[model samples]
Target chain A: MAAIPRLTSRLRIAVTAPATVWLRGAAQSHTWNRLSGGGDRPRHLDLATLARLRLIPLVGFVVAALAVPVTASATTIYAASSLSKVVPSIAPGNTYSFAGSDTLAFQIENGAPADVFLSAAPLYAERLHSKGLCSTPVVFALNTLTFVTPASNPAGITRVQQLDRPGGYRLAVGGKHVPLGIYTRTLLGKLGLGRALTKNTVSSYQKASDVTSVIALGSADAGVVYTTDWYANTTKLLAIPVPASAQPLIRYEACVVMRPGSDTTAANAVIARLSSLAGRQALFNAHFGLPPKT
Target chain B: MTFRTGLFLGGLVVTLVLTFLFLLTPIAALLLQVPPRDLPGLLRDTAVSSALIVSLKTNLIANVLFLSIGTPAAYLIALGRFRGRPVLLTLIELPLVLPPAVAGIALLTAFGAFGLFGSTLAGLGIVLPFTQAAVVVAVTFVAAPFYLRAAISAFAALDRTQLDAARDLGASEAMVFRRIALPLAADALRAGWAMAFARGIGEFGATLLFAGSVARLTETLPLAVYAQLDVNLDSAVAVGLLLLAISGGVLLVAKLPPLWSSAAPSSTAGGW
Candidate 1:
């Protein structure tokens, strides 16, 4: 820790030396006379002087940046993209990074500084748990795949049957490895429309939120997204119902990641909040299903 | 060496070495993740091959377009003495600084389905958002500024007296430009194009947002890395390494002395 300040100061001195030498060269140049002052001394500085002046603030910024301390007490929660809105709202103070569940898991496996891990599916949580990167998974909330179209309904897509035909309309789906995509593909297969709809897919985003955005922006005629995501964007999108029988099991799981130097108590509190009754109410308000009875 | 000179040189070398280590660590880590024997199998994935082909094809066409149009634009701005030239220069360089996400959204609002000219494009039966052309447009929009900025600097650095002497010798303005300006600026222009091409090759956010990440259709190498992340982590790492290699190759080719030295008036000219 003591060496850090010394190292940064050394770096600062090293960077500053060249700029000073270059500035002196510029001040002596003939172009400096023509450009600014015609040999007038005051306000006669060249581009290098101005550049060096700019460097003062930048140097201060780097020093200030190095001086600032990292807040180890603040927890960082790595959650799935589907929980982008709700998780932050529920756990407002801590840092949050939302993406595909698998991507978050991959990041955790590779040593991200995540205090808590919230996955949109059990598979990722289980994988992390098995690897001893996280605690045993606990189901927190549930979601189901549904078709969503832009409010403008560009292709006039209303019924689920419209998606069963290839080239019927431009579709956005999640990537094959992402939980949303896996659930979407499973549901489509259950409905016997996987192959055809796969043909129609124009984009397969790794993040579930991207699917919603594409449809909401009217870039794609429709896309598959979680019921919660559709509910969150009710104004921009209209939803098409999925047959109950065709709905794949969509669960969100949370676990405390075993990262070194993290606030485990704070991490545990976040997981507890998600599994609590208030958490269930928040999830319900956002249209997420409660975990079915054991 | 004098004490002051020695101190300055020591500081400079320290900074240089620090910067090199900072930049090279990530590359070294990326290389370590993928074993050499796994390269062929990773490249064999049809999706990987498709991404490579798409990136190369779109980047090639985009580079050609950049050289043709960007060179002239840079020349005009650097020497035209026209009104609003600063504004034009600023606009050209704007995309270079704009966030990639912002660039993507801007492109969508200008050329998207519901954008200003969306209906006009639709009237022409043209849909661009999910097509390969959209990928090219995204790359062109984000990458053109690199070449343009470099080209402008190259042109601006040329000696004005030589141009005037050519005109005094009864050479046409166009002839002077073709013979004097182009040759003098060739090395810098090549370097700039390499930068733009490299940027285009690595462009992901804008292309994904504008063109949509369709396999083999709109997916570039960076997009392939992203798309394959969880489908196969090894494949993702392999694709990332490929992009790094390609970008490094571009920089290397741009630096090769013999290819650029032919046009130089002095050995040190265009050394950058």
Candidate 2:
């Protein structure tokens, strides 16, 4: 009889402890709910709390109805390394853009998202087209290669053939892979001046801008850069003619990257602008030559 | 015990794993990508050889200049009781706060063709821009502060009593500095040297602006890596891997001496 009373007392203590805990939890939750703005609580409570819940799915449905997928409206253009000096002035609305033809090609090959590509050379554009990474490319502008000298013209390098003079003056050229550099080498080779020029060429830079900076800074006696670049830096540099045998006509090309099921209207509009009179004027203003009549 | 705690822990672990994945995987991939056969040919390239030699020579010169000049300057800023000490310290550390590009511009404004010293230098027939000398100047500008800051803290932590004691024993001030101060500050000096060397090696923006990238002349390893990337992607990767390997070796050499000493516990059994 004594053992039964002891057991009953222990049971009563356990039951009362749980009741106190439940009351405390309820008061705390109510205070929190009042402090906050009575935000919605989870409806799917455990079996112990199911009797006090209300069901509502309309709020979630309303939020779902209001949501819309966002798509990028701006076009990103990746331009060639040499065009960096001039392309920014022509981009529509100055949307997100990156410059560097080789870098851009690498980026595209690595699947970087870009809408359009403008190359300093047709070969790169053709390569991208053949790889199915870009649509058919069109030649957009023509450029003439010119030998640039510092304003002082210490070496008096008036013509391209002087690039081969013995004990020749130090010259800066673009890296072998850059389009302008490759073209320059081809022209030098055609004139039988490649070997002699190579001996005097002190360094090769990766960009035309680098070559221009060198010439402007008087680090080199002369360098080859675009006519546009020469005009842009007229005060610091003077352009001397590359002999007809040593100059190559350079052409620039642009292409739109085809995206599956996406509207090509904006891209086609940009292409149209390239062919328009105002666009040609913009090119002329940038010191680039007009596209050869055809 | 609750689901929220479990979710939080899971999220923390995921973040940590992702950080490791993003930062370390590329380096790991580089090591894996380099074939053993190509290493010899890649290292033998005249440009690569020249770049490596230039990097070492320039960094050594930079380190020496940094220590010789920066140590005393740092000590003065750290320990001197002057009205403008805080301001002076801030001025000394200004380069640390400036972006590398801004540092380049700052250097140019002071030393370029249209700069304060430019016309005078031109009169003397001293061209400081776009030359090997310019490379040294640019590296010094960027890397000196790393040594200076380390040295300042090291000097500040030194016990003044040791120096006073040396002086009281009739030792010359130079002797005290050489024997007492330098020995005690050896570790800090080593750390400073490491920082200066690393900074010199990694210096790009200031170098590009001041020295200009001229292959085999002004081009250091980083510039070489950039130049190679333009001509040959494989060669670029090879250079990058070489840089990575050298950096790894430096870190290992810095740490392994201590690890080896600890590992050979028996070697220290007779130590006083």
Candidate 3:
């Protein structure tokens, strides 16, 4: 019975206490400042006055953005997200924007500022070429799709056939139009397990890296990703080589983007390095397959 | 008009118009790309229809969960004069500042198959990540705080004297809450829920990271837009417009008065 009054008092103070505490803290700080011989000055902004003042920075940002192209020197390379790990190592000095190849192609078509376009699949590069957004696609490297499971093998998957076994396991793949996604579906279709595999797919990521992450995190029982992706995450993933009969010939294509104000000379040089002996060796070391001889 | 005064007014109007245009241009672009005449055909695509169903179902479940669980928690924080109350509020509001990507990874580390309680959850025959349930959890983590913060403010703003009088009349805490606090805070609570629902329906990064985007399973509207981007630009634009319309409708409906309340003449103002 006596607890009710205590509770009521506490409730009454609870809502208003923070304001008083803040005021008391401010007062104590002011006293300390005076004792230390510091000059008095209010430390808070007058928000009403700031309403107009804020536009100065906004205008400055607009001006700076407009002025950037005049002095921009670094070559901007738009590469597929799959090349994110290897591209910088191959060529260390350029600005790179890594995303889905299809997305990069679409952006180049829609006028994104890119000097070079490197894609995991020839399809996106061909699309850009047809649109006159880039040079003719060049097959610089090749990759093959492989099955990867979490190191723990949570679903106890040992072979590809179990992917469609009874009491199905979760599988993560790339999105429908993603190069890896297209290749995975093609591989499954060739193996005559397409229907069953589609049923087992739980997530389709836009980035191949995301598919690897999901598998590595044990969020999915298994996933299909590039041979290079599997090698990059070797510690977290156990790879199951795709059967040769169904393995798709995954090609890495590159071309110089034809946007206005782009550094085409530098972009072409970047492409040259990718197809050069050192670049092919670097890709080989990273487990990417070399393109067939012309 | 004085030159300086006229200049200030003109500058203010220009700023307002610029801000409005900045906000509206993207919406206008979406409308132009995917006009109303093409919506029905876009909806016929199984991926778009499945994504819409998944979004509505998951967000609905998430909002209901928020109302049931969040309201009581807010009341406790507002009224409980406990130690660490400020800390508690900060923890509740932390998700508001956390990038949705960070929230996704946090969820993964805490609840994923190999997370902190991985074996414990596995023992219980539960796998949270990569499912519709995971979608619900992702949205709840990021969106619940919006409702909780609003609810705390509303409950704290209640008339303490009326509450005290009710207690003096021998009303139990539950009775006082149901009879007084709940009714008074109803409007703000609805608005908070609507905001949360809007945020949940459009949740992308976290859901993509935590739940995985499988059409008809875990893909919400935003994920659908991303997925469609690579497939068909027009389809992606159509889905984005649908999401915008749904959010707009939620805000509109939440702002309007309840039909029953509006239908009845207010006794407080009646002299007829």
Candidate 1 lDDT over residue span A1-294, tens digit each: 444445445555766566667656555555545545666556633455544444533555676998999766678999888788887877788888887888889899989999999999999999999998999888888888888888888889878777777667788888887888889889889988867555675688888887887778777988888888888889999988778999999889999999778777898999888877777788888888988544
Candidate achieving the largest TM-score: 1
Candidate 3 residues B68-173, lDDT tens each?
A: 9999999989988999999999999999898998888888989999999878988998888878999999999999999999999989988777777778777889
How do the residues B93-212 of candidate 1 rate in per-residue lDDT, one tens digit apiece? 889998997888888888888778888999999998888898899999999999999999999998888778777777788877787788778889989988998999999989988889
Every model's Cα RMSD, please?
A: 6.4, 13.4, 10.2
Docking class of 1: acceptable
User: By TM-score, how accurate is candidate 1?
Assistant: 0.88
Sort the predicted structures by lDDT, highest score first: 3, 1, 2
Number of clashing residue pairs in every model?
Answer: 0, 2, 0
After superposing candidate 3 on the true structure, give the runs of residues whose Cα lies further than 4 Å from its correct spot.
A1-70, A199-201, A292-294, B1-3, B262-272
- Please give fnat for model 3: 0.68
Candidate 2 CAPRI level: incorrect
Q: Output the better candidate (2/3) by DockQ.
A: 3
The collision pairs in model 2 are A80-A101, A81-A101
For candidate 2, the per-residue lDDT at B57 reads: 76
Residue range B211-263, candidate 2, lDDT tens digits = 76666667888888877877777777888887777666665565444443333
Tens digit per residue, CA lDDT, model 3, A59-121: 545667788766667899999888888888998889999988888888889899999999999
TM-score of 3: 0.86
- C-alpha lDDT (0 to 100) for residue B173 of candidate 3: 93
DockQ of 3: 0.37
